[model samples]
Target: METEKQYVIRCGNGYVRFNLDGSMIGCKYKSSKTTESHMKRLPFNIDLAVASGIIKIEEAE
Candidate 1:
């Protein structure tokens, strides 16, 4: 990515920008907002039945 592009940092997370020499340009602790909506997301489906002949992938999708 280009350095001119803006970036965002999240809470409990930080970013390390690298330079062309493969060195860290700088490190910054970004303050990103957390929404409860994200927490409400369910885990990915990994049921064997879905992959087997029981259910179709379209149904899971």
Candidate 2:
């Protein structure tokens, strides 16, 4: 079976996961200084993230 491809971006002290269609899957943070509220304030769309020019996209597996 074929599996769907997903992308990830490193945002601040965490990482954001999304699909090719620009839909956000979720976000995870490794630092205790980060929180969900902080992430929500950031862009969630792929285009926005790219336009911001602060995030790097990578294929998930």
Candidate 3:
């Protein structure tokens, strides 16, 4: 079976993963200062991330 396309964005203390449809898959934070609440405050949308230079659209292998 073919695998679904995915994307990723490396943030300050972690990374955010996304599906090809621009929906968020999940996020991971490495620092104690970073939390789900903080991540929630940031834009996770693919288009918004691109517009803000937060990430590029590249298929993850």
Candidate 4:
């Protein structure tokens, strides 16, 4: 089995992380300081969101 590395991007007061293949895996809420917050997957790509001025992606470490 292959495990692709995940990527995290800043969103609002929280964060959204997706797989290298662009699948949303998990997220966190700023209020509870937990990554277990459930979120809806966007119909478009995260990269596309950045390109289209929908969201800004933060630099990943």
Residue 5, candidate 2: C-alpha displacement in angstroms: 1.1
Candidates' TM-scores?
Answer: 0.25, 0.38, 0.33, 0.37
Clashing pairs in 4: none
Q: What local lDDT score does residue 38 receive in model 3, on the 0 to 100 scale? A: 36
lDDT of 4 by residue, 1-61 (tens): 9543333456655665654445654466422221212222444555577777654554334
Candidate 1, residues 20-56, lDDT tens digits: the string is 3433333354322222232223143324433554322
lDDT against the true structure, each candidate: 0.31, 0.51, 0.48, 0.47
Off-target runs (Cα >4 Å) in candidate 1 are 1-4, 8-12, 31-61
Question: What is the Cα-based lDDT of residue 3 in candidate 3?
Answer: 43
On a 0 to 1 TM-score scale, where does candidate 3 land against the true structure?
0.33
Off by over 4 Å in 2: 17-45
For residues 1-61, could you state the per-residue lDDT of candidate 2 as single tens digits?
9544544567665676544344554466422232333335554554565678766655544
Best by lDDT: 2
lDDT of 3: 0.48
RMSD (CA, Å), each prediction = 16.5, 9.3, 9.6, 8.1
Steric overlap count per candidate: 0, 0, 0, 0
Candidate whose TM-score is highest: 2
Question: Any idea what lDDT model 2 has?
Answer: 0.51
